[model samples]
Target: MGKTLALVVFAAALLSAQAPAKKTTAETPEARAARIHKQAIVVDTHIDTTMMLGRDGWDFMVRHQPESGENHVDLPRMREGGLDAAFFSIYMPGTVTGPEAVKRALILIDHVRRLTEQHPNEIALATTAAEVRAANKAGRIAALMGMEGGHMIDDSLAVLREYQRLGVRYLTLSHSVNTNWSDSSGDKPAHNGLTDFGKDVVRELNRLGVMVDISHVSDKTFWDAIETSKAPLVASHSSMRAISGHPRNMTDDMVRALGGKGGVVMINYSVGFLSNERYEAQQKNVPSAELPRVSWEKIVDHIDHAVKLVGPTHVGLGSDFDGTTVPDGMEDVSKLPKITAALLAKGYSEQDVKNILGENILRLLEQVEGVGRQLRAAASKSD
Candidate 1:
């Protein structure tokens, strides 16, 4: 009895001496990393945040408190999710033509500037990749601008150059409409792709150090831009066609070519881009759960494909929050940690994840800037 009691006492003592494993503190490196990613320079290259800015009943910076709603982005939500940067789209509709379209573009650009001016401490305007980093370091949301449709420039290189001067860093050569020079992927094969002027836009963008976003351009236009630009291009918000055969998606060949060119294909988080079932269900207006997820697994699959094509540096995230309905797993900007965890599970090192999260985009932007600088120098020498 005495020996048994002694053994029991010893066991009790051992248990007491060992402290229970505590939950990881939010302040821990892992927690901080998750938090930083949520808060870090998470950039969504395409968001229709400016769409609501022109409307009377909408406010962009307020945290959306209502649980049931269709809106995907808001300032409070961004704060909660740690969203540090985003490209507010001056997205124009194709219906407006000529001078009217240019006017609308200006209105949208003004609205974006107003939003930034109103939220000076919380947000700041950023034109270059360097500005994005500087703005983030200063603990402010970097509100970069991009013109979604080339038509917004009114078919004038002067207008396009003006938009660039107004802090626009990238221009989507086509936006579901065929421009005088470039054809859109949304339209059936026309113009056989980009015309000479379309190629000029690419050249000018490269010379100006402005990024050429191939999203929404025709496959031919996409390839043409790739061949024409002196700087690495980006498909700002697109997905791999191997997973979902949407015409809007980049084909395996395109993905491979983009990787080969050292360009980054930032994964689009739209459900339609993630899975075939989801794309079909979305087309059929089916509810979400019934639709397949571009699960963290599927996202990894795209990243894996990118790795096979481009060797990892060419893949990045471009969650189209506020622009379109994203996948369920990526419902909001806040759920980015799940992506990090999923990436880790897929054997992506911390460095690789970091690159995917934002580094690649930064590097590509810098390349564009470098090209712009060289062009300016050459122009000056010629003068």
Candidate 2:
């Protein structure tokens, strides 16, 4: 009888332990968001905060912790968003060209270097995949530079190499303006595509292990880049034109091609990149050419579309915050969690979401670095 009683007690104890515990409160939306966000490796590809640092005379670190104004990114906001890293654009304005544009690029590059020098603890200047990992381990944001226009080098491969040595990892090849070797999507008459020199630029970038970014190139130029580049390339801040119909956006074919090459198409969070209607709406109010371009919720929709088209591997985030106008809900970098929640609702797997947030970018970075290593080995053998 005593043995029977003890067995009953043991069973009772096991049952009690197995019972579902009651929550102190229901899992709040905020709490769930925090949990999911912590599991992701968030990356914003194209934040233009450097432009603010240069043009607006804004500080990047704590010395001037300005409120989140029209500006969409700050160091604190990045921490809040759990952003792993970002490509801080050293975007040269298209209006200035030749010597003036090169001079401007040099000055901006200096500004980026100074900012990194000033905030060693808060940010690290990354030029390779290894540096990105080291920066993440150091608990600081990995700040990498991407030259937004090929014009910045003034058609000089030597100048391009100089920028690369100075830590510029990717070159957009063109902004809104056509270069001596390539026509932009924004350029009229199209020039058919990349010139012979443009092809040389592609080869040179591959040789140097620098990424070829196709954000503002014409469709012909886009295909040419894909064909010429031995290494994978990225559209650091582009959206699906199938949804928005913007020439500045990538078509479904382009996204698929990028995926086929094992590259990433980071969705730009510009409202204009999201929907044709939103773009037309803004165009009416603002001049055709101006700063502070705005984006909206449809931005998430475009991201969703890219993922759907190319599965998850091809898509990632490039918010274009501070560099261009962002959408309404994503007013600042801290609001990145909202995108996470939206992505979750759309039924993306946690691994896929994490890849879209940052992993794919890391993969592309590694690929570029590998190409760089190979080129050097070949050159050494020749020597």
lDDT by residue for model 1 (154-206), tens: 77899989998888888998988788788998887677778998899888888
Stretches of candidate 2 off by over 4 Å are: 1-29, 55-57, 63-70, 282-295
lDDT of 2 by residue, 1-383 (tens): 99999999999999999999986878765676677777666777798887777756565653323253647777877887788788888886777788888888888788888877888998888888788888888887888899999988888999999989998999998899888888899887455688889999999999899999999999999999999998999999999898878899998999999989988999988777776876776667866565344445677788888887888887889888876656666777777888777777777776887888888898898898899889889999999
What's the true lDDT of residue 68 in model 1?
Answer: 63
Q: Write down the TM-score of every candidate.
A: 0.87, 0.88
Top candidate by TM-score: 2
In model 1, the runs with Cα more than 4 Å from the true position are 1-40, 281-297
lDDT of each: 0.80, 0.83
The residue-level lDDT of candidate 1 at 202 comes to: 88
